[model samples]
Target: MPYKARVYVTLRASVLDPAGTAVQKAIQEQMNVEIQSVRIGKFIEIFLDSPDQTKAHQTIQQICEQFLANPVIEDFCFELDEIPRVSNLASQG
Candidate 1:
């Protein structure tokens, strides 16, 4: 079966986010609403096929830890879903 993984990479809480702070200030001024804080992050989507769900989970974890996120400053998490197999309805016609 095939799986789709959604990954989110974020700066560690102790790390400062200048970009996010700038955006927050801009938004507060433009909208005239009080805003406490904002943090910037990355969103990544990956599609892969594996023999089983367990393998898919492991692969996604390795990919995130090794390639997608930086361990020292960035933290990462992922959500996995099995891609549904749908029949070709048009071909049936």
Candidate 2:
């Protein structure tokens, strides 16, 4: 079976995000809304083939911790789902 995983990486609350601050300023100026703050993050989607759900979960965790996210400043999380194969007839109908 094949699986799709979505990973989200976000900067820690203590870390400052200049880009996000800039966007917040722009929004406040343009919309005249009293927005307190804004934070930016990254989203990543990965598709892989794995039969063992347990192993897949562990692998995703490692990937996020080791490569996808920066432990020093960023935090990460992921969601995994199995892809359901569609038959030809299902598509035609």
Candidate 3:
């Protein structure tokens, strides 16, 4: 089975986001509404083939913890879903 993973990485709440603040100010200037705060984050996608979902889960956890997200100042979360294999490649096209 093929799995698609969606990862979301964001900075911790205690950390200051200068880029998000700048974006908020920009939005406030263009619009006539009061904006309190804005925070920027990252969205990543990973697709892989695996027979064991548990192993895939552990692999994804390791990937996120070791390579993707920073454990100190950033937090991350992900969702994994199985994608059906396409058997007919030239069915319509």
* TM-score top scorer: 1
Ranking the candidates on TM-score from highest down gives: 1, 2, 3
Question: On residues 2-63, what C-alpha lDDT tens digit does candidate 3 reach at each position?
Answer: 99999999999999999999999999999967999999989999998888788889889999
User: Candidate 3: lDDT of 42?
Assistant: 92
TM-scores, all models, native as reference: 0.94, 0.90, 0.90
lDDT comparing candidate 2 with the true structure: 0.93
For candidate 2, write residues 1-93 as lDDT tens digits: 788999999999999999999999999999999999999999999998887778889889999998999999999999999888778998899
Model 3 regions more than 4 Å off: 89-93
Model 3: number of clashes? Answer: 0
Instruction: Give me candidate 2's TM-score against the actual structure.
Output: 0.90
Off by over 4 Å in 1: none
Q: List the residue pairs that clash in candidate 1.
A: none
The full ranking of all candidates by lDDT, starting with the best, is 1, 2, 3
Candidate 2 clash pair list? none
Q: Determine which window of 10 residues in candidate 1 has minimal summed lDDT.
A: 84-93
Deviation from native of the Cα of residue 9 in model 2, angstroms: 0.3
